[model samples]
Target: MSRPQGVGDGGQGHKAKHTVLALAVAALNFGIAQGFFAPLENHPSLLQARLGLEAAQAQLRATQSPVSLQAQGGVSFFEVTPPPGPPTCPNPLNPQCITLPSDGRQITLGLTFTPFPFGDVSDAVNQAAIGVEQAALGLRQARTQLEAQAVEAFLRVRLAERGLEVARLGVRLAQASLEAAKLRESRGAASPSEVRQAEASLRQAALQQADAERNLTLAKQGLADLVGPSSDPPPRLIVPSEGTPPQVRQAELQLANAQVAYDRAVRGVLPVVQGSYTRNTSDNDSLTLSLNSRTLQPSLSYTNQSQGRSAPQDRIVGTLQIGLSANIAFGVLDALEAAQKQVEAARQAVEAARRSSKQQEDLLRSALQTAEQGLANAQQARSDAERSLAEARERERLGLASPLATLQAELALAQAQLNLEQAELGRTQRILDLYRFYALPLSEVNR
Candidate 1:
């Protein structure tokens, strides 16, 4: 009230605005979280992969169950006419001849189980089981890739924000420089050329601001495309100390599948054994057992039947049969050789994948070390800029330097700060690359 506090209200408002902006900037600098990728679960590609895995699992279950059941029902009608004279009345017959109409209905339900005593059934089941495992690994591979993409998108947004912050500071410094130059020109201390240079610098700063704004907008859009318009800051990504690369596991599964195939091919036309028990509504029950090879089959069956309800007499029958067969085809041998080759190829592929993975891990570690060095350089540059800015301000206060020089020093400090941020981003990116390469989960926030 002594000098009217309202006069300083504009300064207070500016301070408040700057404070809000600072907070906003701080909020933008958040780490990634496991929940950041929650929306990825519903992504179409991931959903499709999940469905594929489910289908593979269902196929496995079906292969494991060899039993089957069938139900059948039918109706039949018939009419019979007696011959006209009934064999010229050779036997005593009724004078009136009539047509007989008959209708029959039957319902049958049958249950059968066929078990392969040889390796055929086991081989098929194992193949199906392997398919399920492969599908599962495929899903994991897809998820890891998607998570890496999300991380990159998030980093892009953060980088854009940081760039924008630097651009804004640049604009402010340029504006201050332009004002100082105009004042000096009005006092005959600076020439018109200096004023024009200051104006050009301001325009350049404005251009940079525009570019940064555009970049930020694009980055935000890209991030929204993946996570669907997330306003909350992402949590920091935590790198795991150790983990297996997805490629290694995928290669291992492939090797397993190939080995199974090779084993089946090596079996080379084995014998088969089957047993079945079937019952139907026609009062018929049967058990059949068979053992067969490519060249011969021996079968035994037992049946119990009641022909009609009126008779109600049980009939029992047993039958044995032997069948001989021959196949001139020699494709089995060729298949065995091919399968052997495939097994060898898969083994080699596994080794190759492991080697490639190790190489990538080593490369990422080296890159991370390089990123650390870059960050250190940026920190040192920023320190030097800070000292220069302080000296410039002191000189300006002592009337030994122009205000524009002080502003230029401030701009340099801002640039150094931006470089430090970029270096940090680079380091984070290298770490993320390592994490993705290892297929490590990003949920470990403690680290």
Candidate 2:
């Protein structure tokens, strides 16, 4: 009779509406999940740490670069004229100063290079290498510190949220008590004072709720500042596994770097032997050789020279000669002594750092243990409070308890819940702190 038109249209509309609702619900759940599990990469502290690492890497590269080479070169031009009215030419074959050229010009080109020898370059290279290693350690420390900050902020936010929930629950219970008091007053079963007291409690509960909300906002802002801004909801806080603390690793790295620095300093005052060969070509050609002992302050040089211009009858000549020099500096002894003392100091520093790291680790372990015990006790208190609240509510419904008594029980339960949340948060934070000490990533908790 309906020609199936209404059945087809109506059925299609119902299916479409259901499909839209399902899609909306799925999207909401997905968004909640995403907010609850924000990745560490989004954290502002980690981003800053990454930037620091990049800077450190750049510094290391600069440090590792080769030293600048030392070089000098020049050209000189000059003219020679006969002195006074006399000719000083040795050749007598030509009279009237014909043997000497009236106008003569001379040009000279010279160059010198001081190569970077092994012994001479070792100190600088060693220092640069140590710098690179130190930079790497700095980057690691920054990352560890950033992760710890992010974890702490996340935990605070979770605590604030739970506190807000307890506050709201308290407000609800206070309102119920106020309504009961008013009814009892109307029946002359309770005095007007009870109603006034209930009203005051309600106001107090509202104030607490407002304070909790403000705390939650501040906590969320702190976390967002560290992780960067995000549209997604905040993730649940998870307790990271206990791992190697960053402080220990950082201390070890410092000790290693100090040792390297001390070794390099010692090498600075040590003996260095260097050799060089040089060649020069100008009006005359020459070869020069040199050796130096820096520790002894002794040096030797040899040179061979030949005249550039010559005639058959007047031949050019060649000559070779050797020279030596030496020096003594009292400052060298002082420098060497200072370096030795520095080495000793570095060794002591290493030992001190080791002891400090050990103590810190022990303290953190003890703290974590204490936090775990406290959390257990809070959980037990919370369970007891729940049972008490339930019994109070039952007695009130049975007319065996006053509305005020039931309200008091409810408040106690809320307080117990708040304490339990704090205990849980504290325990988790302590665990994360231990993990952070070991330089473990917060993301490891997900695993």
Off by over 4 Å in 2: 1-71, 75-120, 229-272, 279-327, 388-413, 443-447
Superposed model 1: Cα runs more than 4 Å off: 1-32, 71-118, 273-316, 320-328, 394-402, 444-447
lDDT of 1 at 258: 89
- Give all TM-scores, in the order shown: 0.73, 0.66
User: Which candidate wins on TM-score?
Assistant: 1
Residue 322's lDDT within candidate 1 is 56
lDDT of 1: 0.73
| Clashing residue pairs, backbone N/CA/C < 3 A, model 2 | 36-235, 43-227, 44-226, 44-227, 244-438, 245-437, 245-438, 246-437, 246-438, 246-439
lDDT of each: 0.73, 0.64
Candidate 1 residue lDDT tens string, 251-332: 8878888888887766555534333333222345555555554212233344443333222333324445555443335687
Report the number of backbone clashes for model 1. 6
Clashing pairs in 1: 31-234, 31-235, 31-236, 32-234, 32-235, 32-236
lDDT of 2 by residue, 323-421 (tens): 444344668667667766766776676677667877887888788789999999999999999899899999999999987787778778878877887
